[model samples]
Target chain A: MFLPMVLNSLNPLLKETFVNELLKCNERTKDYGLVLTPEGAESIIEARNNILNSLGRVDMGIEVALGLIENFYTSTFINEENYVSVLNEFQEIFYYMKNETEDMISDDKLICIIKDYYENLCGGSLELLKSCLEEFIHDFRRKAHTAEAGLGGEE
Target chain B: MEQRDNSGQTLAVQSKINSTNLKKSQYTIALLNESFRVGLMSREEINNIQIQIMQILKELIARYTKGESSSVCAYTAESILNSILYCIDAYALGCDSPEEAICHLKSLQISKLYERGVKSVSRWLEEARELYKKVRKNKLNVGLESYDHTINEDIPLYFTNCGIVFDAHNGAASIDYQLTFDDMSINGILYMKNYLEHLWIENAFCKYFNSEDIEKLLSDFGRTIGMDYKIELINIFELVFNNAVFAILAGIPEGLRISQYHFDLLSGKLKALDDSEIDKYICQTVEKLVKNMNICELNILDYIYRYKTVFTQRVIRLVRIDSLRGIILTEKEEIKKGYTILFENGKEMKIEDFNLFIKKLMKLKNTEDKIALIKSGIESLNDFVDLLASDCLFGKEFEALFNELGDMELAILAKMALYEEIRSDFRGLRSVISEKKESRVEWHICFVEFLKKSGIDRIESIERLLGEIDYTEISFY
Candidate 1:
């Protein structure tokens, strides 16, 4: 129904830029024995677009994907076998967290929080990490509500 | 193909350029649609504009998120997009014609058009502020809380909290003050500017009369509406304007004051004319008002003329129904002088005596004997009203008492029953008195039912007595 909006996400120029930017991430991840081929990078970009569209979000650049690749490349849980799929799942989770937090937390801070939960808390189990993040989001919302009420009382 | 008419002359082809085809508020969308429909713009050009709008949205979203996030929810994105279109609409409306606006849209960059629109919105906001200042300076010295809050809190809050960057088109205020001729088609700061400008003009016109007279006019208007003028959210300009027209029609020397005598005079004068005659008379009186008041401001004159048609129609309807008192307001002092009941409470009977009297009246089977006992016992109007309130008078007894009362006594009872509905001439009193709906007060319902069953001559006499009785002279003994 949103023809114009769908066309916007389908712009060839934007797709090309996202693919090229994702491919450049191999330069840093290759040192850690994790590399993404051009085709894999294209798939990752396609995954990002699908996730963003489903979540009713718009991304101007490939920052979220790059952040995921950079933050999780050093982890022992990521390998060549699971590299592309894990990055795709992390991209979806990252955008979901952005909406969950109401975009209050900064990009780098949110990614650090998620990486910490994935490594130390969930021991790199994606399912445990998802549940852990949900708990964190619930607590985050309660704190925000309390803070807002406090401010209202002060006013 | 040029076709020849029967006279052997070529027929003139009508151009498809209609200025009103574009809505004032949705100027950009309307202009682009019109442009594309007429082939002045192509699908490719329209798509390019949409793409450019998306690009601008991306830039704005970056600023909104402060680069912390690269995306926002679809609702936020759409809101930003509408704000962008709102700015573009502002600029397009500033252009002389839709064709000119479309030409600019095709030639200029979308960002540049948005920038120009932002500038226009900023200027309009400033103009609205100035108009608000003038409105505050010349505001009517009335006691309406809604009007005060609209001026003192709501509009100022809007100015302070309006997000010009992302939501320039949103009218972020809760305005409660109503104008007689408010234009609802406009939105955002432009609507606010228009409202304030119109309000300033209305205030300026009201300033022509002294404050006391305007205050009295509003009070009288409140009385007719059965509300406290201090709390009601009536448009002050409407009351002042209507009374000014009435004052002119009644041949008052000057000012916007209409006394009870003047209202009665105007009522009689209007009743003599038919519908068309009333229309013609009002039209001429409005013209005379403009000339006599020396209203030179074109905006004020235009504002008055804008309401002339509806006002003339209302007056004609009221006259046709013989309810001109609805528009013609009399001062409260004059109303007090006109309706005096001189009600003095008789000496209260001892509780023992009152209880015995009530017991004796309740025991009497005949309605006449029961009413006679109550009338002989209840000497004061208060006692009589209280006796009615006490439920001592049964169903048949109430009608029996009403039949026994003289015209003046019935008039007194009717006045108390229909006090709120009675304006100068008790217009429409019969309908109100005869309404079948039961009143919350038991005595009121019974009294109205009795009046409904009474003879037409009796009702007319009570209506006449309602006019002659001076309510202000009422005193308790």
Candidate 2:
């Protein structure tokens, strides 16, 4: 009840700020024949909030969502018909991978990595993108372990 | 409202109440709960305060992430919330009373209270640092590992690693050095500061005597407790203070050392007194001891007076049991006689030589030839223990070796095998070893099991011989 009250107080303000930011994304995406309606932006914000809450993550603002939209809107595979749903799924995967990576990757770097895999590697296949991210996380952990061992040996 | 007392008389409850029942560490929560219970605060007001705290947490999280990430994990948020609450609690404790703290909580913003708490923590940390310096300067020159580690390592690490912003409530140091009376209520830098202040007072009292005398007193106390003085975690001040009280009672008010003769004299005198007489004598002696020592620090004097009642009770109980010797420790006189068996470990043999010696011993058909080969071949104690562990000797051969060994050699083997259990009471060794069947090494168990099967006369001689062996002179390899 207390946690709900805290999130409730933060919800409306966060929704408004994010909705405004998502609508502003339409200005750039319109060049690629992509535009988000107010209803679509609201739905995206709601889905983002659900994913974040379910993952036990707190977001300061709509930066990561905006970053995802900015990177994926220019893709050749995305169209207006599948725009909202695809953005919602991308938000879910972004947060999941964020947690899986243990927050070791910065936001911008993680966004760049996700965008690179989605656009070039996975060819806009959501399932393929998820698997690629998992593999990337595994390799990252292995490399980190090896680096730690090297440092320990030096010490 | 009027409340009924135990006598069934009605008394009007006052508006203001004392803060005696409030816990200092949990001042805010305790005050809030108490105010709510007394009907001074409403449920709606408490909810509003919680909402304010949540708002403060939201802002803190945003600052923590630097406006980049929209959210953090639940664990991070909870840690930040606890830090925020810690700051608020620190500020609440600074108020004059629980009533005033509750009033401030209701009126002021949570952010303002958190800021004040942060400042108070910073100020207290500085004061604690100064107190630590004083404690180090006046530290007693005793060889206590815990004391030295606490002063040299733990406190310095705390100052270097304490996170005031995110983990203000955590007392970062593992303080192993114990005080005479430790307060476990308060926490964080406040607790550290209070601990240092009390330690300074205790160190001040101990500074009255020479460090060598205190060291000797600690050594004697450890001997009384059946432990080595250097490694034991005994409080130096408590030992010195208790012995000083006994020294005064023994008519040696000018010094701290109490000899065996002094203990005997005091034992006879204390046994004749009743409980009340013992109390009166101890109180007068403590007063005289304080005056003679010229301990002028009021804090130290108050500390000593506070422990007087407990000390008096302990003395009276010890007196009733005719065991005042537990508290009044006499100096341990070193044994002067030369030991019958001076066990010096021989030089280690080469691998080929050791194998050839074992081969030659095993080929011999009789036990006497094997014993002679061992006595001449196995030079080092390691090789001897290794031989016992090697299973070269069977049942009758083990008995033959035991028959050949003298009482002193058996005692030496017993001392090595049962190093921990071998105390002043040699009679308890058999039962202790039987209870603690496990030992440090494989050879130790084999040696002890053989010694247990040896006859009662041999066992009794080994126990008597253990009493004569000066364990300090012999080194176990």
Candidate 3:
């Protein structure tokens, strides 16, 4: 489904030949592991509808909530190998911020680590993380353009 | 009490556990992916394809980790995470737009990175099981060694009882190190607990089965010679446990299945091993028995019976009847079949009776009185036997066996069904009796038993006939 759309966008002539075929294929929408099956798609729609109705976020555009994934991983996670020692220090400094379970793993330590990185480090702050994510489609378009050129060169 | 088939309940619980394990494994994966959606993939599962994407990103982070900003293609790393996060958020909100994109990478065998906390507990469980076997094999009973201060030396037991509160206020990051062994998750702790539980259940079942496995192991081993030590036997068990790996591996002494038969054979070979070959096999068979002693026919009771002197010299032990697991010379044919001890004084004690008497005394309110009666019965009988054990003149040798009463018993037995029979029941008269009694072997035995059962103390008819035969000097006792 994605392939035909990209091909049609790049070449208007390809649309007439590939678009119908691809749309027909997407109707069944089945694959072994890819999970683009008819059942999976239906589940996605049902879940989305549920979220929209329950959270009252039906009006929220896809773009509005798009950047969260980047914020979570790079900023929040502690590297496992360095965690034991680092977590201990993180725990002590963030002692007041700790919840019961977090006594072993300090939340304040996570905040402190992030703050420490912000003050001491450069280039990959949360702001930079978010910025990197925001440029994704534009960068993708550029890569696609170069990829097309490489295909032409082979021809 | 009505019996419900709880077997189904056990199966249902097992299935639920399996389903939970799968869910936890997946949840852990999703939790990790949340991290990779950020600008650069966090270094998580090194072999993972998503981590490979971050490996390229790490080329960029190397500069950051080392305090130097290395010039890199910002657009290349930036857009992937951007699209990924965009898709993730849309996915979270039930939007298919960005997910459509992230799904592409995932289908291409890509997995997003997660923090170390989001680990597959199953791995540790597998590791712990492996380690336990290794430790047992190494003879490290319970303590863990190697350079000490182990990072993982069992969980902080006191702090183990923790309640999970997925506080939405703290957002999801609060979940990082909140360790939980989902009853469903194949965590090491759970596996360990199961291992212990299975052991307990198996031991219980074995107890009920009378450790038929013990007898079976012994029987399969056939006959072994020489001493087996306890420690070596433990080592053998560790080997078996490590190797067998499943309950089914240790099977019935004799099984129809080819594989089981083979296992029993091999196990027997190990057990029945001669002292010439190996010293101890992990079993604690007769520890008190001498190392080089000729201990044949492993039936504990039989051994105790035949070699009472040797056994008493070794240790005062009891060989529990039903549940017997011993390394004997051969399978005991009639351990419970019971024996009848015929005294020279004409009394017979059945094995079953002796066993019953012992059990009865065990339950009696006054064991001393019951014991005294038993002792007196045995002593009186023994004294009568000792008198015969000394000499032979009793025809008087015959009198010692049947006693003076034997002649009387025969006379009464002979006249039992005859119109004018001459046989007598009295010992003195029975010797001279001529009339034939019941001829069948079984009938004769039954007649003898009937005389005892009838409680007729003397054979008067036989006594009169014997007096006519001029045996006036002889008397029926």
Candidate 4:
């Protein structure tokens, strides 16, 4: 249910695999999202422009600053209506996360919280999503580390 | 896929959907509805429905943002916004369970973009439409030849009913490279680089100006006028235009409608320097250029030739409107909201109907008020002559405190910003771009200010209706 509505009509078989892929993507997003300390988001955002020419992961360093989210707006892009709704949610979520960085939560718990959000708001689809999340986390971690090294060189 | 480990937080969301017979999942979205319904949902319930929709969107994003799908570079600002919406709509219409929803959203979204791309080329069509109207007014017929033929048969903005006509008809090109430096030489970047160079003086002035070829023209003009129009010897910069002149103009590929702002900036840059002050001026111009242009454009070793230009064909003509009113940052002719009013004829006419127009303009709540004001001003605008006729009133003493009607912002505020920056950074040169140019108006100001600044003679005869607004350095392009 937390899945963005833009991708709502899933074929029965592909649904089984897609859930896993999405979970993988989420993990990567999370890993990338938690690299920057809250204060570093601006610098990271500024760095995004520089990213045009190079493979350096300066933008990844920004998420490292944001850290993990317990209850944030869905990161899903969907139909116009849903897109707007989710954007509003993220606006609040990002603001709130920026305001409260000292507080931390476990990865599994965060995922569970996200699932709960989906269930209540739309409906529920948890297992397939979780299966794919680990891959996303791996990719995100790798990228974040690369960006961290880049930050070291700049200083 | 494994079960979600749920020893976390849990809450039971109350069914805000009060009516039992109505399917709660069938959320009524006001904007998305087929315009036929007159049904209304309470504000709170509407919000809940939207939140549910957002959750569906979140899931869709999860479904497709994998593989080489989201990696497409042709994506645009609108696309990013649209794709998110597309998936959500697919979700809303589907009866499939969560697993099946992902694939459907992904396939549908891509298909829509693919299908729409064929027709969504309305961007140029819209541009063509605007151009058609402008061309009709100006009575111009021009055509563009893009190398690629795909852009052909593309319904342009101008309409002949059978086919859309475009002012400039062309397509993108993929060309075979003719170079020694590999594929980098084949980049379609010359146009882009040229564009950036226009707005940012540092980027293009020297490149275009310092060329031996350009020097010949400048020297010739100088000899002809009995005064040097150095053109590019001095430093330069611009605001509102991209970092460089070329870069800024690049955004609007069509020829630009030149304004006082563009001229003012050019004058501030290429105006002649006195022989005695030449060295100081050179230092200042160089300093300003360094601070503003993209230093990366040229190799450091090519300093001598990087900016050198043999100025030729690209002839620029300028005329500046000087005033202390609402001319600052004026990208277009109409003055600021609080300062001046423009009529259909492109002239500022606020003095006669100032109070009533302003009071109504201030309370402008919707389209009707704005339209009414526009009509009233346009209908009998004999009181306000357009800037094209300013020549008629030249050499007159006018009592209008909000001087100059044409869109020029280089008056006081511009002087102030330039003064502050130059004094701190390029101070030794006496910070002159803001200084009055060689003009009869400056002669009058010099005569007046000389009397005021040092108890001498003033414009002793205060004649009726002679343009009293006197400022030195008014540009004549």
The clash numbers for all candidates, in the given order, read 6, 8, 33, 88
lDDT of 3 by residue, B53-102 (tens): 34333443333224221211233224323323222222232312222222
The full ranking of all candidates by lDDT, starting with the best, is 1, 2, 3, 4
Error of 1 at B233 (Å): 2.5
Runs off by more than 4 Å, candidate 2: A1-102, A150-155, B1-21, B42-44, B58-78, B321-323, B335-477
Question: What is the C-alpha local distance difference test score of candidate 4?
Answer: 0.29
Q: Lowest summed lDDT over 10 consecutive residues: which window, candidate 3 chain A?
A: A58-67
Model 4 C-alpha lDDT per residue in residues B391-427, reported as the tens digit of each score: 2222222112123222222122222323333223332
Ranked by TM-score, the better of candidates 2 and 3 is 2
lDDT (Cα, tens digit) per residue for candidate 2, span B136-214: 9998888787888888999999888776667777774599898888888878888889889888988999998988888
Off by over 4 Å in 1: A1-20, A23-62, A73-75, A79-84, A152-155, B1-18, B271-277, B333-477
TM-score of each: 0.73, 0.75, 0.17, 0.20
RMSD of each: 10.1, 6.9, 33.6, 26.8
Task: Give the better candidate number (2 or 4) by lDDT.
Answer: 2
Off by over 4 Å in 3: A1-155, B1-201, B209-225, B233-477
Instruction: Report model 1's TM-score to 2 decimal places.
Output: 0.73
Error of 3 at B206 (Å): 1.8
lDDT of 2 at B190: 82
Report the CAPRI category for model 4: incorrect
Instruction: Give the per-residue lDDT digits (tens) of candidate 2, residues A1-155.
Output: 23422453354655686789899988899998899999999998888778877787766567778988878888898999999999898889888877887777767778889889989999999899999988998999899889989999999
Off by more than 4 A, model 4: A1-149, A152-155, B1-56, B63-83, B86-414, B417-477
